[model samples]
Target: MNAGNTFEVEVRGIRREAETVRSFELWPLGAESAESAESGEAYELPPFEPGAHLDVHVPGDLVRQYSLTNPHERHRYVIGVNRDPASRGGSIRMHDAVTVGSRLTVSAPRNHFPLNEAAVHSVLVAGGIGITPLLAMVRRLCELGRSWDLYYCARTESRAAFLRELRELADTCPDGALHCVFDGVPGTAPLDIRAVLAKHGAQADFYCCGPTPLMDAFTAALADVPPERVHLEYFKAPEISTPANSQAFTVTLARQQKSFVIEPDRSILHVLQEHGVAVMCSCREGVCGTCETAVLAGEPDHRDRVLSPEERAANRTMMICVSRCKGDALTLDI
Candidate 1:
């Protein structure tokens, strides 16, 4: 991630994908100022790798991470959001209230689950709204004339977004490279992993992003293949085994010069936000890096999905959403 390259962007457009999913396009608000200064008109932002995602700050709500669905060379940043009924009201508000002109603060793109370099072929499996990241990969691979196959599975055709474009691309591609499997598709079974693996063998690199059960099924089905060759992007954090009735703890904000006690059942993020402190965050499950804060003092029980062991050891940052303090109190840079 480029430290000085961050930009605050505004929503330029919004498009609905499904009843629960929407796509938003963002552009830098300072583009005109930069261009007027003859600093060279900012071209479309640099291209992100296949699995890159951006952390978007939704203001009153915590920051949230969304997969980039737009092509790399596009002049704007595009992200697809699904209105998760179980969400802590973030997705619901984003889907219902956010408009075309809304200003959303965003972090630069980051890639933790990049594409495999060794494999000559690629197999992308996307379930439901999980198609967002894979769609970007498909666009890039197509532009490069690379060999890849996309298997998109959904409950029905109505719930599937970008079906028309995907089908059109597959038709023009030499072979039938794109396959859509719907549960309602009469004679066809939905995403036959066993058959797919048996036919494709272990030669191609496999990428999957979707619900936990779908990912788990793929992981089990591809047990014969090398684990390193299989990549999975999870939208949520894996269930943790914290003490059933974990005790509450106090977190001190060094910059704000304040401290708050988190309830046994609540997270540190809730406590800080209740005190009117604006902490960066997204994906309360700890999967995304949006809520990461600088740990100025104290040991952190890191529970985020993005940070590596080395990152955790650095002790410079911590995701407060799901992560906890190891001791009585943790001091944050705020």
Candidate 2:
């Protein structure tokens, strides 16, 4: 989707999965609605790549990133949000205050880790909420008649959001290819990543998205494979490695006409927010592109996972969450 285009949408529906998780359905407002309806509109926003994600601005000064879980042909945008009690306030606000009629601003979809071209056979592994992007990939693979398999692991069957749908899709495949591994199943064992890899490794491309521990295990277990053969998309950015004797810095928002002194222990985004500067952000770890802004003047110490090498070379956009200004004073577009 175009980076410049944005939409104002209202929550059309909300469904709670558990105490901490919820699914939200949104629709575009005003004339865009009529235009979409006329064209048999599926998504309120532009069609996105299979693994694309969007930045959602929630109430209580919260901005978060969520993967688009619905197929590209669907009429509405769907996101599954898991509330984190330890979160700064984003997830809590989303679960508590967001309702069927609540309104929010959403940025266009962004894809930093698009599917690779050499993926002849696909193997998708998902854990819990990590299934969002993989669900879209499954749909795309099915439509293309590509060889694919999905291994979905959850704490229990009831906790899996689209268990029924996944099972049906698996049944309809040319050959049975879906495997469900429940953590608490009486008879079934936990997911055996090694066994799965041993059987699927030769000609398949492995794409994994999950929690930190799961991803970490996959990384360690798959170390023998070529890096290009394995793909990963994280819901959170990698942690920053602090340097010795790092000093504080100054940041200037050229558009907003504001400036702030950011301590070494604080992130630029946190410092800006503390000063009451309105900035958009999600996935504060830096994987999501919601908090990205244009760099007007200064060298940026790029630390985010979303920007491409070319995008970074251009030095135009920067993810404010984890990225820092390299120079003593930095200017931003706000």
TM-scores of the candidates are 0.75, 0.79
Runs in model 1 deviating more than 4 A are 1-6, 30-39, 42-47, 184-188, 243-279, 291-304, 307-334
RMSD values, in order shown: 4.7, 4.0
lDDT of 2 by residue, 177-244 (tens): 78878887788777788888898889788888888777887777787877667878886755557866
Q: What is the lDDT of residue 296 in candidate 1?
A: 87
- What tens digits encode model 1's per-residue C-alpha lDDT throughout 226-286? 8667777887876657766466778888878888887767898888788777766657777
Name the best candidate (by TM-score): 2
Which ten contiguous residues of candidate 2 have the minimum total lDDT? 29-38
Which ranges in model 2 have alpha carbons more than 4 Å from their true place?
1-5, 15-21, 30-44, 83-89, 186-189, 238-241, 245-263, 270-279, 293-301, 307-317, 325-334
Question: Candidate 1 at 117: error in angstroms?
Answer: 5.1
CA shift at 235, candidate 1, in angstroms? 1.3
